[model samples]
Target: MTTQNLLVELFVEELPPKALKKLGEAFAGALADQLRAQGLASEDSLVTAYASPRRLAAHVSHVWLKAADKAVQQKLMPVSVGLNTEGQATPALLKKLAALGADVSDPAAAVAALKRAPDGKAEALFYDSLVTGATLDTGLQKALDEAIRLLPIPKLMSYQLESDCELPGWSSVHFVRPAHGLVALHGSTVVPLKALGLTAGRSTQGHRFEAAVSPVVIEHADHYAETLARDGAVIAGFEARRAEIVSQLAEAAARLGGGVRAIEDEALLDEVTALVERPNVLVCEFEPQFLEVPQECLILTMKANQKYFPLLDAQGRLTHRFLVVSNIRPEDASAVVGGNERVVRPRLADAKFFFDQDRKKTLASRVEGLSRVVYHNKLGSQGERVERVRAIARAIAQPLGGEALAQAADTAAQLAKSDLLTDMVGEFPELQGIMGGYYARHDGLSEDIAFAIEDHYRPRFAGDALPRSAAGVVVALADKLETLVGMFGIGNLPSGDKDPFALRRHALGVIRMLIEKDLPLELDGLLAGAWPVFGERVVDAHTALADFIYDRLAGALREQGYSAQEVDAVLALRPQRLGQVARLLAAVRAFAALPESPALAAANKRIANILRKAGEVDPHVNPQLLQEPAEQNLYQAMQRFVPEANAQFEAGDYTASLQTLAALRGAVDAFFDDVMVNAEQLDLRLNRQGLLKSLHEAMNRVADLSRLAA
Candidate 1:
């Protein structure tokens, strides 16, 4: 029953910075999960994960030294197989008992003790026993092995361990990195286990150069982080190290004193945190001439290539000075700052050179080079894709703004991918559309056209801003639709988590543009226009592509706080004008919350069923056939309310339209309750069906209210 806090650490060579956070979380989560599954750790146990550039560790509280004993019931063979006709134990039963490590001295007595339970049509014999709990040593070993096997390693490093760590011969081991040490502590005692050719010990190596002690001694399980920080001079926890770096970056940026701040990028911060153990943010600078080149180029080079955070001024302009997260905090610190500055100058110069050289050739001149660059083997060259995109863009633009916008969109789409041929775009592919815009401006093109080229790739990810100009909107929509239709046409749709082409993102981009821009374009018309651009290269994937877009839209609406029922009610119609979907959903939600919503929703569901079963009945209510008082009352209600609701619907007042129908709830409910829909007379039955059909049509204008029924 004794329990103790446990600590585990795997020290290794530097890990891939981008993947370190995931690796750390997965390692800690898998280890703790395995321990809990084995009953060695309780649900109340707390797990703290620590990860640095060189280590991944987990400290778990209240881990028992041994798991609790578990009761197990195992079904044996049928009674007929285990016992003879005379109710005596058979040889097979004795063999089975012997195999189970049970006493088989008297088979009859053993069989008599077995429980009888009915399994299907036959009675079966069952054996129950207490399973001894696993010892901590064995459980920890299994958990460690599983955790290591499950680490989200970006790439595995294979190496031979030192002879002393394993056998005398060169023993090959593959891991995220070559393991230098493994520390496993249960309280103050060392837990006997081995991983990656290293035995468990209290000593683990810390910061390579700044450690107070080369081999940090973790005195106890709970003392891991504090001890490492004090003796090893390393911030062992990933979040702790990141917070320290962020604080240091802010402090350093403040010293510059011109409303300057380090550029904020979570991914960049995480990567930099994973690159250093003891972060010491120091100020560094480059020549102001480098700033003359596009700030994006300088920023990208500094952050992506050098892992530096560029300081930005009050006007959002990149400052010459940047912050570097140095691993060692030397007293003077001059050498570290100078070294980083020197290292970064060449990277900046390269970017500037690429930018300058790229400007010499206009985007128009480079358009021909895209033919040499293949976009996709099956989809043809970038040149061909550009032509297709231009065709789609022009088609989209004509309806929105006549020939002026169409020409602008066509011009932008033609030059959008032309930047791919530029040296700057080749050096930094992230700046493709951006450099295209810059070069378009340099070519003396109109600002609108240049902006359209630049903004064509807007809203690349979720929550990103859409294109600002009419031309940009047209080009952006065309670009995304082409990717969606082309990819879906080839049957390369996203399955589960595997979307190589990012078709889901493209679909979402199209949906956002249509809905957010409130562009009068219909989804079916958009797809019909995009499909022909591919000609025979693509199959008729219009229907499939539209469905995929709707699926993404449904998910997006649900994420925006609509319940599944509410979203289903609205999206069930597959509304063509996605711009109105938000309005439709709002109306549906408003209608569902009303006092009369439940009754009306149920009646609408009943009416739908009745109409479906009636098989294509006209909604024209023949008043002469309305004999019952309930049917006649419903007829009068429809005549009085239907036209007003239709007027509200035509005026774009969906909420008012749906709310207006709530008045007929009484008549609708009474009609369903009192009238016989299937009367003996054919004319009466048809009339009743027609009245219900009319009600169904009016109730579902905004959404399929029946889908909201419980």
Candidate 2:
């Protein structure tokens, strides 16, 4: 067998910039996987993917010209069914051999060649055959077809190509983009194949306008990337081009020498990389007066609308100058720079105008407008939702900080959704809460209230920060709770991956605030408080929403490196105060490490089963009914250790509480080993069950130790 590097390329119109990275990876991975599955490539083969705005290509090393032959063993029918007792081949056996392309001319010889093996209770005859290897041409064709079929195209396009035959007609072809050329090479030889109405060739177009040659010609499979780069003026590899863009951006920023750097956004970087072939970083600037608006507005417009990276000072303030990644490198770059600057001025002016006009009416005045904005058909308008949040926030703050905190929370909640009616926020929905804060300050509201109004939507996504002030925390919790309770009440629960309302995110947000903020709030109590705000619009879904929150908490804990067993042990108790869950988990982990843990866990599990079967056994054990020595000793041990564990638990030392309870492992194990929990006498049985019941409660105060049982 001979091996050589292989290369394949598809030249087409521009692909979707956002999907190009994933599309390139999927194509190369699928192609290499198919080759290996067909035995045309080994496990040690190196696969390199190349993607640009107009092309997708792959280079694979150590691909075989023809796979090696393999021996295959196939099970035939049972010996009794294939052959008769007369030691002669039946018609069925001969027909099976013929279908397998075996030598059926000599039936006796064919029967002798079959091997008998025991399959279960019966013996079956097996046939052995040598499977021929697949040639590179056929293997590559199959691989190419599979790769194209497996592309994760966001959408497909249909186009027509002129008929190549004598008939004057056109044929419709569907693909991600219109395919213009296809190239497949093995070493220096072109591999013949056809895909998307295009034949394999050695030439592919490169950068649209800057290519040194008309169509870059790849002479060998190993020289594809180098040839394309040198003659086509394009960087073929996606990661390589992205890295070049990053380096150029840094070098250009360093030249300004003001401790200025480009805003870091990986998604913007990747999208920009996909849109260009040869990246040429250029410095562009808008008027400094545009900075009068919020830096967020300017940055969002530049990155989201213009695909530019706005420079920021060391203190994270936006500067007037920005960087643009142009696809072409012109000798006189002044035109490109000036053109981008001119294009961005209008966008900035629009944002400024919206911001300026939005401040004319205070947030209080806009509160009336939210009544016309629909939030959910079943949940009424944003105005109605605002009242629900205010009620919930007041209930939450009354217990945490008394009347002052309640007043602040109420004020913030009232104005929170008011910004949804503002022109600035109406134009950019991402800035709803932020614009509310700015306008609140302009309305002469206190910093605490303004911050709360802005920070009420904290932790909008995973790893996002929580509210800064106490009032902000209260308002954030209330807002998320109202949404969860209302949605779950109305039966709009998330199913599978279709979370249109992002209910899961809202649940996690509530859990994060409750636990991370260490608010002295109980989960059930919060749900109860939120339930009445919706009145009759929603049904009783308190239980369902609480379960949803706990499920999200368990998943988050596991993601933070807690094992499934550990999470299950602690969450099994449904601890209402989520702030204590982390401590409970720590205690469970500490208890699990004890030398006596396994035996105690097993004993605890046994006791649970015994008590469950006993049905409502009281925890009161009569000292006189303790006949067995083991039972009496266990009772005495509980008297000494149970109080100490209870005291530690009351003091919030969960780890100490669990460890103190671990002292009774010896007595617990002895009792389970020596005494019968269900005795023949009714009084004796109940007394023993009571003792075990008492022990169960003490052991599980922190976490259910039985879950730690192997």
Candidate 3:
């Protein structure tokens, strides 16, 4: 077998750097898939990708030459027809010959040719074959042709050339940018590649800026990447712009007085990657006064205006200077620094204005302004949303200590959206909740409530943080409920990856508040109560959003490494009690690792098994219904155990709960060992089931202990 290297390079007009990065991996994976589908990829086949803003390329090495030959046979359809009474060929049957493009007079030969002569190859000699040409090497052109068809380059266009070669439109792949051309070659020789109608070649180009226009002539496909690398391109295969930015940032930070503190900004990195060819860092300073205007606003300015990485001091505090990454190096360096600083000035100045104006207006006064601002096109305005949230806060407050929590939540919600209308948040929209916290404090809200104002947006990203205080948790839940309800009312819930309303975030936030904050607020009741105040105009707003937030609970738990099976088991019993599910999950996880805990798990498993058969159990399972001695014994044991299991679960002492629940194993096992559930007497069977139900019911109060896996 001859070893061969295959290379295909798509040279296009400047491509979006971020797009190129993702597209690169997609290209490689797609090509490998096409090879498998075509029966070409083999044991040694592997695909590698390389991308730059101007081009995306992939190389397939040691790929199988072509689909292996297989013996072929075709089955002929059986035809049976008869004439009326006389058993002769009828006119209808005779006329069918013409429809089949055959004549009755000459059909014998055609029929005979399709007949199988034997069970094996003896049959092949008899049947005529419809053969497709096969080659040893799959080569490169068709692979590229498949890539072009499946690549799905966003904002794609068509590239038509008058080489007089014929191909279908879908196969004649074009892109958003002009493809300077594609070079498809196997082992440096032009392979017989055809689909998009181009054969393999030995030539490629270097970096658009770094290398000369003269193509980097290649000797072999194996050397294609190295050739380009020698021409000042690193083609190990990823986004060059991002790689360069990270590399240059690290180098630059090491040279600075301290490390370049990385501020979290993936979105900014994506946007800026497209704006550069090569990334270089330049440290620039802003006025110290700008730091006072909220680090969030200043950082956003640094990222938005300058595409810079913000720096942090030794104390993890935002410094006055930021590191701006430019695509091209400047000769007069000071000019670039001045230009970025000038551009960011307006953004920071706007922050200062929002702070001052908001300071002048009491946080309490902002409540009235909320009513004036529209919350949704159909769900009234900010004023209406505040009203709904105030109601929700009260609904949730009862579990969190009704009146005090309610007041705090109501105050926070009243002032929450005020910052949205302020100059700073309007300029830096991400500062909406942050500005609210600032004004809430100035207006005399207690520290807890003011922090709640800011923290309502807590954990904007997964694993960020849960609301820190009871008030903050309530308001966060209220805010998320409003967003989910408002958006869902308008039919804007997340479907797959298309969450236009950020409903996933709202739901995750709600779940975080429920579990981490341990708010015992019921989702359905809260939404139902808030609907009259907020959901009157929206369609199916109550249940729709309740179910949506519930779904997010599963997702949040899954992210923490919970199994789908475990989630299903817990959710099956108490779907809405997200905090309860979390608590039970901990107990089960701890119990599983305990060597002595299996007997307890076995007992719970027996309880769950019995509960499943005795379906639709009442929570008020009658202990008095117990007729058997075992039934009476189990009821007393469960009565004694419920509080302890509930206490362990409540305190998050899962290990303790496992011990407490396991303690009931002896009584549970004894009851099952000695008892019969479906006795001949009706009252006794129901009583036995009621006894088992009591055990299941008590354990489920903290968790469906029966749901615990052995």
Q: TM-score: which candidate is best? A: 2
Tell me how far the alpha carbon of residue 271 in candidate 3 is from the true structure, in angstroms, after superposition: 4.7
TM-score of 1: 0.96
Q: TM-score for model 3?
A: 0.77
User: How many Å off is the CA of 318 in candidate 1?
Assistant: 0.6
TM of each candidate vs. truth: 0.96, 0.98, 0.77
Give the lowest summed-lDDT range of ten residues in model 2.
608-617
Candidates in descending lDDT order: 2, 1, 3
Clash statistics: count for each candidate: 0, 0, 10
Show pairs that collide, candidate 3.
65-137, 65-138, 157-175, 184-200, 370-383, 371-383, 373-382, 374-381, 375-381, 375-382
lDDT of candidate model 1 versus the reference: 0.90
Give the alpha-carbon lDDT of every model.
0.90, 0.93, 0.67
Q: Please tell me which model should have the higher TM-score, number 2 or number 3.
A: 2
Q: How well is each residue in 43-111 modelled by candidate 1, as lDDT tens digits?
A: 999999999999999999999988989999888799999889998888888888788888888776798
Q: After TM-score superposition, what is the CA distance of residue 555 in candidate 3 from its true location, in Å?
A: 3.6
Which stretches in model 2 have alpha-carbon errors above 4 Å?
none
